[model samples]
Target: MKSTLAILAMAISVPSMAIAQTPPPYQPGMGDLMVTIVQPRHLKLGLAGQARNWDYADYAQHELEESLEAVEKHIPKWRNLDIAALMAATVKQPLEAIEKAVKAKNAAAFDASFKQLTDACNACHQSSNLPAIVIKVPDASAFPNQEFRVTRP
Candidate 1:
């Protein structure tokens, strides 16, 4: 009877022990999400457009949009400013233009739209009082292992 009680107590305590050992969920800061998620997608989009890789450009653009959406959802406000509103005011239109350009596979349009997007990013930074965070057209590929230029089939 004592052994049965001891076994029952151990079973009940096992779950509590596991719960205590588990770490808290990781909640990344806004800057961390931007650096880890948004920046790479933006770079890839620029590189794809520059290389005239429309398919990759489209994919990159979509990824960027999703990253931005995720950021807005995760951190709706930063420094007391509404991030969603800021994004809508700044990057939203440019992203739409970029999507249209990508769909059309127009290199010229893509270039112009990409410039607009880059400028919008800079503008957002400035408005957010992050004047030092200047974004521009990517002149060099950040991913050395990945080829930006599409090989002709």
Candidate 2:
């Protein structure tokens, strides 16, 4: 009777012990998801906006925002960087202006806002000690067969 009880207890306790163990949280030092994902998306969105490809710009904006959110969700704090807030301070104004222009369908306003967004991208890169990664308004179409001209709907 005691042997049977001991076996049963061992079985229950063994599974419980296995279940209790968990992998440690990921803690990469730098050049993590923020750089690998978030930063590039930000630069691309700015370039798309500058080209006045509203449809593509909107998509890029959504992608950039989602990437930023994902970075924050996966790794909320990195190297003591208030990553979300830092990103906000750099991009918020330009993003808001772009949203307003996009709503109004004002080409002039969109152009100006796009420039601001590009500048912000550079600013952030410089602030992050990544000045080598310069961003600018695209001069020539890089994506072939894709329209960047202002278009309806």
Candidate 3:
């Protein structure tokens, strides 16, 4: 009878120990999410456009747009400013223009739209009092592990 009680206590305590060992859910800050998701996608999109890799450009552009949307969704307000409204006012048209360029597979238009998009991002930063956070055309791929070139059949 004592052995049965000991075994039951052990079983209950084991579950409690396991639960205590589990880590808490990860909740990334706005800056963390932006750096991890949006910034890389933006750079890749520019590189893909520069390479004239239209297929990859289209995919990268979509990923960038999605990242921005996710950012706004997760952080609707940052430092008491309305992020969603800011994004809509500054980025919506430029993103649409970029999407148009991507669909048409026009590298020149993509370049122009991408410039507008970059400017919009900077404009948002400025409005948010983060003038030092400037975004620009990527001169080089920060990602050396991934290929941005078009794969010709």
Q: What is the lDDT of residue 18 in candidate 2?
A: 81
Order the candidate numbers by TM-score, best to worst: 1, 3, 2
Report RMSD for candidate 1: 2.0
Query: TM per model?
Result: 0.87, 0.60, 0.85
Clashes of 2: 0
Stretches of candidate 3 exceeding 4 Å from the true structure: 1-23
* Candidate 2 local lDDT, 115-153, one digit each (tens): 887788778667777899877766655446655555775
Model 2 TM-score, all chains together: 0.60
| C-alpha-based local distance difference test score of model 2 | 0.71
Segments of candidate 2 deviating more than 4 angstroms = 1-51, 149-153
In order of lDDT, best first, we have 1, 3, 2
Residue pairs whose backbone atoms clash in candidate 2: none
Tens-digit lDDT string for candidate 1 (1-153): 999999999999999999999999999998999899999999999999998998888899999999999999999989989999999999999999999999998989999999999999999999999999998899898899998899865
lDDT string for model 3 (29-83, tens) is 8889878998989899999999988888888888999999999999999998999
Q: List the residue pairs that clash in candidate 1.
A: none
